[model samples]
Target: MEFTETLLPGVGVRYDGQSRDGQPIAIVVAHDGDVEIVTYQRTDPDAVQYRLELAAHAALAVAELLGSPRVSARLVDLTREIPGLHTRRLVVAPGSRYAGRLLGDSKARTRTGCSIVAVVRGPDVIAAPAPDFTLLAGDTLIAIGSERGLEALAELLGLTPDDPVPVMTAPV
Candidate 1:
């Protein structure tokens, strides 16, 4: 589906699109993290059907439920916005060496030139985790760097380079 973005100037940005079923929908993202989801009546395009508003934090919780694919999609969009940079999700397995080790122990950033921007542990997201933070099994590390750096980081984490890592960018 295609979406049209309209800048609200003093407010925020609005994205207008049609749902797969041909329902008119508009998503407005405010500067302060408020989100408004508006749907229009099918019979009367200009008439309102219903509107749902979500606070920033709430929207994030919803996003988590929607899973990492959506996040990856956004990351793919990010890759398009910035040339050459890439993002990938690395899952820490139960048998991995870094399963119970500190973040600094892997020296991931220094060794692979990739920064672990966030760690998704279950329902919680640890943003910009410090080196002292302990990594647990099942923790999904969100890292950003050059593609080769990402591959190196995966290797450093004891994970095979081809093990389900969602490459954020297509082959160029």
Candidate 2:
């Protein structure tokens, strides 16, 4: 989908786009962190059907809910472009050996050939995290590597070969 962005001078900005079904949609954010979402009628795209306004925090929550899956899919596609490369989302379980350790301490990349590209903690996404980033229990790690490398990384994260890697899901 193509999005058109317009600056609102002293105000924040406005972003407009059309849904796959051809309905016009827009989001206008104010400088004070207020977000207004406008939906146009399907029958007449120029007609405003509804408008929902939300606080900055609420808008961020909604965005994350709607965007996480797409981000994961894009990551997978990027990895697939290179031969023998793969992408996996691994959660740090409570009992995992690396649960409370720093990423650099685990030397995951050196030991398993897998590099962590992002860390999903609650509603926040830390992309290209540094080695000093802590790996806490319940954090979902986005790692990229070869199949064998991913398996090794999983083992290092305290997951057995028989354990099924959970698919990346929107954070609660």
Worst 10 residues of 1 by lDDT: 163-172
lDDT of 1: 0.79
How big is the positional error of residue 6 in model 2, measured in Å on the Cα after superposition?
A: 38
Model 1: CA > 4 A from native: 1-61, 64-74, 159-172
Local error of candidate 2 at residue 158 (angstroms): 0.6
lDDT of 2 by residue, 14-62 (tens): 8899777787799897866678999987688777799999997787677
TM-score of each: 0.54, 0.54
Error of 1 at 150 (Å): 0.3
Clashes by residue pair, model 2: none
Tally clashing residue pairs in candidate 1: 0
lDDT of each: 0.79, 0.78
